[model samples]
Target: MVTDTDGYIHLVQYLTEHLGIFENSQQQATAEDTVMELFEAQLAAQILLVCGQNPSLTFAQRNLIIREVDSIVYDLEEIFASVSTDKATPEQTMFITEFSGLIKNLFDQEIAKLHLA
Candidate 1:
């Protein structure tokens, strides 16, 4: 099976190819890869949210996952602001805003799930 990072890298490559996020493929391993890491946390948060709903994990395990996800959320927010949209067209900007909002909502929903669990 592909590792999470690898899977995300491929997804990023696909997006970059079709979406024109960066100038070249060489950006894939450096800048674009970091963005992939940010989204990977979304997956982790979601999995933990589902896992936390089960009785299999002890309180300590659930808490650990929650803490880690909280840290990831912090990093995600930090990097989010570092990405520039200065050169984007109005339509591109709008699409990015919509996508970012969707991701933010998903992460927020995971936070709520953590609380409920």
Candidate 2:
């Protein structure tokens, strides 16, 4: 799961440096929600990456990918539940929820491809 973690870290850095995920949302977000969203985005991005790269992997690799991605997503969901107590600004909530949905959709699209693989 080193690569998975690295992908998450990379995503965090990319968001900080390029996309301004943190900066854009911080004003509207609770500290916890911002962090949670980062993890969510990382999980989604890695799922998409793994699904896209599935062809290079063996059956074992596919299973590993599924396990790792599922684990990360599960962990994020748990964290989200815990931090969800804080209320965000309406604008921030909208941004976070919509963006979260978009990432989820992206992940779903990629995961769907796994069946074909």
Candidate 3:
């Protein structure tokens, strides 16, 4: 299964491929917002997948996971704010590499905890 990190990478790649479509700040802003929304949705679905795998997870635990996802999404938007729509940069690649690992490590830790419980 593709992780949210992978999904996000693909989405960014797709956006970068057609970056010319965003001719103005308004269009770029709208596209960025849409991307963030999609990432948030993907995070939620990932949470659901995790919960499904760990049926014994309590309601509170699930809620905590949801909150974590929300926090991560917020952080990601902030991190991605500097990304240029007109052209790709080294910073964009660095941001993706850094955050994708963080995202994966976070969920891996969470899943490990669930398994250990």
Predicted model with the maximum TM-score: 3
Clashes of 3: 0
lDDT of 2 by residue, 6-82 (tens): 44555434433533333334346544444555556555665566557555656775676667557755654663454
Residue 95, model 1, lDDT: 43
Q: What lDDT does the true structure give each of the candidates?
A: 0.45, 0.51, 0.53
Question: TM-scores of all models?
Answer: 0.33, 0.37, 0.49
Instruction: Give the C-alpha miss distance for residue 114 in model 3, angstroms.
Output: 3.9
lDDT of 1 by residue, 1-117 (tens): 111234334433544554554233332333233443435544464555456556565678567555654554554455444543223444443444444444444444544655687
Cα lDDT tens digits, model 3, 81-117, are 6543334233333334444454555566666766786
Give candidate 2's whole-model lDDT: 0.51
TM-score of 3: 0.49
Query: Which regions of candidate 2 deviate over 4 angstroms?
Result: 3-46, 83-117
